[model samples]
Target: MTRSRAQTRLMLAILGAVFAFLYVPISVLFALSFNEGGLPTAWTGFSTKWYGELLRNADIMGAAWNSLIVAVASTVIATVLGTLLAIGIEMRRRKGRLVETLVFAPMIIPDIVLAIALLSMFSLAGVRMGLHTIIVSHVVFNLAFVCAVVRARLRSFDWSIVEASTDLGAPATVTLRRVILPSLLPAVIAGALLAFTLSIDEFIIAFFTAGAGRSSITLPMQIFAMIRFGVTPEINALATIVMTLSLVMLAISQRLNRGSLPGQ
Candidate 1:
C-alpha cells in the first residue's frame, strides 16, 4: 500500500509539472496583457486600455479585416471542394496509398517549402500575388484538413441511406442535400472553423504569396512586423485576442466533432 501510494504521488507530480510546462508561460502572458504597466517583470495593476487601443489602431484593424477575408474565402472554397472530394474518395472501394499520400501531402508538407514552391509557381505562371492569390494558396492547404475531417465523419457514415434515396427516385443533388449533407454538417462546420483558424494564423505562406503590398497584409503578418520593431503593450493585447479567438474556434470545433477529429 505504501509503494502504490508513492507511485500515485509521483504520477500526480509529473502531471502537475507537465501542465505547468505547457501553460505557465501562456498564463503569464495572459496576466501581462491586462497589466497597466505592460511589462512582464512589473505589474502596475490591471487595465483594458490596450484592448481599446487595438480596436482603434487602423493598421491593425485593416490587417485583421484582410485576414478575415482570406480566412472566409479559403474556408468556403475548401469546405465545398473538400466535402465533394472527401465523398468521392470515400466512395472508392479500393483506396490506394499513392492517392492517400497525394491527398494528405498538403497537411504534412513543411510550410516554408510549400510557401517557396507556391512563390515559384506563381512567378513562373505570371500570377500576381495579392489577396486572391492568398485565398487560393490557403485553399490548397485548407482543403486537405477539411477533407480529412469530413472523411473521419464518413467513416461511420451509412451509404445505404443514400442508395435508398436514389432508389426512391431522388436525384443525386437532392439525396446529397437531404441525406448526405445533413449527416456531414457537424464535421463540415468543424472543418470550416479549423480552416478559418489556420488561415488566420498562417504567416509564412501568406507572407510569400502576398507579394509587394501593404494592401494584402494579414493579422499574423502585422503581428510579426510589430514584433520586429520591439514588443509593446499593444502586441500583448493583440496576442491575447488572437490566442483567445483560436482557442474559442478550437473549442467549438472539438465540441461539434464530439471528440472524433481527423486523427483520433
Candidate 2:
C-alpha cells in the first residue's frame, strides 16, 4: 500500500507539472489581456478597452470576415466529400493499404510542404491565388480529418441496417439519406467543427495560397503582422478571443466525438 501510494503521488505530481507547463503561460496572457495599461510590469486594473478597440478596427474586422468565409466554405466542401469518401471506403470488402495512405496523406504531411506544393500547382495552372484558393487548400487536409472521424463512427456501425434497407427495396440514395446519415450525423458535425477551427487558425497554407494584397489577409496573418511591429494590447485581446473560441469548439468536438475519437 505504501509503494502504491508513493507511485500515485508521483504520477499526480507529474500530471500537475505538465498541466502547469501547458496552461500557465496561456493564463498569464489571458490575464494580461484585461490589464488597462497593457504592460506586463504591473496590473493597471481590469478593462475591456482592448476588446472594444479590436471591434472598431476595420482591418481586423475585414480579416475576420475573410477567415470566416474561408473556414465556412472549406468546412462545407470537406464535410460532404469526406463523408461520402468515408462511406465508400467503409463499404469496400478489402481496404487497400496504399489507398488508405493516400486518403490520409494530407493529415500527416507537413503544412509548409503542402503549402509550397499547392502554391506551385496553382502557379503552374495559372489559377488566381485568393480566398478561393485558400478554401481549396484547406479542403485538402480538412477532408482527411472529416473522413477519419466519420470512419471511426463507421467501424462500429451495423452494416446490416443498410443491407436491410436495401432488402426492403429502399433505393441506395434513400438508404443513405434515411439510415446511414442519421447515425453519422454526430461524428460529421464533430469533424466539421474541428475543420472550421483548423481553417480559422491556419496561417502558412492560407498565406501561400491567398495571393498578394491586404484583401486576402486572414485573422492569423493579421495577428502575425501586428506582432512584427511589437506586442500590443490589441493583440492580447485578439489572442484571448481566438483562444477562447478554439477551446470552446474543441470542447464541443470532444463531446460529440466522445467514443469515435482515437484512443477514446
Candidate 3:
C-alpha cells in the first residue's frame, strides 16, 4: 500500500511540474498583455490600451490586410488543387512512390532552400517580387499540406461505391460530383483551414519573398520588425490576438478529424 501511494505521489509531482513548465510562460505573457504601464517587469493593473493602440496603428493594419489576402488566396488554390490531386492519386490501384514523393516534397524540404530557389527562379524569369510572389510561394507549400490531409481522408474511402455508381451507368463526372466529393468534404475544409493558419503565421518565406517595401509586408513580417525594436505592451496585445486565432483554427481542424490511421 505504501509503495502504491508513493508511486501515485511521484506521478502527480511529475505531471504537475510538466504542466507548470508548459503553461508558466503563457501565463506570464497573458498577464503582461494587460499590464497598464506597458512593462513586463512590473504590473500596474489591467488595461486594454495596448490593443487600442494596435487597432489605431495604420502600418500594422496594412500588414494584417496583406496577410489576409495572401492566406485567403493560398487556401483557396490549395484546397481546389489538393482535393483533385488526392482523388487522382487514390483512384489508382497501385499508388506511385514517385508521385507520392513529389506531392510531399515541400513538407520535408528546408524552407530556406525553397525560398532561395523561388527567388532565383523569379529573378531569372523577371517575375517581380511582391505580394503576388508571396502568394505564389505560399501556395506551393500550402498545396502540399492540403494534398496530404485530403489523401488521409481518401485512404479508408470506399472506392467500391464509386465503382458501383459507374457500373450503374453513372458517368465519371456524376460519380465525382455525387459520390466522391461529398465524402471528402470534411477533409477538404480541414485542409483549407490548416493552410490558412500556416500562411498567416509563415514568416521566413514571406520575409524573403516580400520584395523591398513595407507596402507588401504580411502580419508576421510586421511582428518580426516590431520584435527587433524590443518588447512593448502593444506587441503583447498583438501576440495574444494572433495566438488566439491560431489556437481556434487548430481546434476546428482537430474537431474535423477523428484521427483514424490512413487506410485503416
| TM-score ranking, high to low | 2, 1, 3
Candidate 2: segments with Cα more than 4 A from true spot = 261-264
State candidate 3's TM-score: 0.92
Instruction: Write candidate 3's Cα lDDT for 1-264 as tens digits.
Output: 999999999999999999999988877887899999998788899898889999999989999999999999988998999899888988888988899899999999999988888888888999888999999999998888998888888888888999899899999999999999898888888888999999999988888888888878999899889999898887888888888898889789767855523644
Per lDDT, the best of the predicted structures is 2
RMSD of candidates 1 onward, in order: 1.9, 1.3, 2.1
- lDDT order, best first, reads 2, 1, 3
lDDT of 1 by residue, 1-264 (tens): 999999999999999999999999888878888999888788999899989999999999999999999999999999999999999899899999998999999999999999999999999999988999999999998999999989999988879999899999999889989999999999999999999999989999999999677899999999999999788989988998999999999999878877444445
Off by over 4 Å in 1: 259-264
Q: Give me candidate 2's TM-score against the actual structure.
A: 0.97
Task: Give the alpha-carbon lDDT of every model.
Answer: 0.92, 0.94, 0.88
Which portions of model 3 show Cα errors greater than 4 Å?
Answer: 1-19, 259-264
Among all windows of 10 consecutive residues in model 1, the one with the lowest summed lDDT is 255-264
TM-score of each: 0.95, 0.97, 0.92
Clashing pairs in 2: none
